[model samples]
Target: MNPGLHPSKVTAQFEPLIAAFPDWHWEIRNLTIEGDYLALHLRVTGTHRGTFQGVEPTGCRVTTSQFTLYHLVDGKFADVWDLVDTNSVIEQIEQGKAVL
Candidate 1:
């Protein structure tokens, strides 16, 4: 639930992430809504233009896929869970695996 990846939960925590990836974009490829549960398939694209998780900027472009599930309560978001393919993104930035 921490948007900025901080251990502590805080609102607007994604500000640092926005600074780190100024051009970051999360595109939803698929979505399914059933009752109070919503599922999202996404592709996240960005450039490592600033520091993240203490890792210095690499200026590398990264693309990663993720699946997220959100629980709704009274038409508002209550809880969220995500499954991201972080290894693929790391390989792109560090090992030059994918060519996108």
Candidate 2:
């Protein structure tokens, strides 16, 4: 796990992500938490106001879905994984399907 992610794991990912984003955030839609497993379905929306993927700023609005899962251990988070609709986002960017 990246220590930089989340401050003490107390929903603290927002801090680092905000620092990196400085533009937008992950808009959550559906979240499920049971036992040591955490599941989340959300959308990552933002403008390329900052450097991302070695690409310069485009100032375009981007929105993409993300599915994430986290594993908890000893009460604190232990492991996590996530999947995003990369092709959809890429097509949107390349084909101007969403213009963002």
Candidate 3:
């Protein structure tokens, strides 16, 4: 998890991504719950339709993986950590694969 990031700011951080990939979809590949912790493995798919991270739209369909964990406290999320395969997404965009 990024030290400078707080969970409350997550939505703001993702707003640009949502705009860039308006049709982005998330699929849960795996999920686990144990005690006060929950974990997820996810597959994300989308087409680059708008500017993102200073990269111009390439119209490339991209697939990436994400892993996330959350700590629950008294039935509410108290902390969250996540990792995304951003390098893969960038490589796919740079490859300029035609959208299917």
* Each candidate's clash count: 0, 0, 0
lDDT of 2 at 71: 87
Q: How well is each residue in 18-71 modelled by candidate 2, as lDDT tens digits?
A: 443477678889999999798999988765455454445555566888999988
lDDT of candidate 3 at residue 62, scale 0 to 100: 92
State, as a TM-score between 0 and 1, how close model 1 is to the true structure. Answer: 0.76
Q: Estimate each model's TM-score.
A: 0.76, 0.66, 0.85
lDDT scores for all predictions? 0.77, 0.66, 0.83
TM-score of 3: 0.85
> Residues 1-100, candidate 3, lDDT per residue (tens digit)?
2233356587887888888888889999999999989999999999999987778899999999999998887677777899988888778777877322
What is the lDDT, from 0 to 100, of the residue 2 in candidate 3? 28
Model 2 ranges off by over 4 Å:
1-20, 90-100
Q: List the residue pairs that clash in candidate 3.
A: none
**Deviation in Å, model 2, residue 19 alpha carbon:** 6.9
What ranges in model 1 sit over 4 Å off?
A: 1-11, 96-100
- Provide the lowest-lDDT 10-residue window in model 1: 2-11
What are the candidates' C-alpha RMSDs?
4.7, 4.6, 3.9
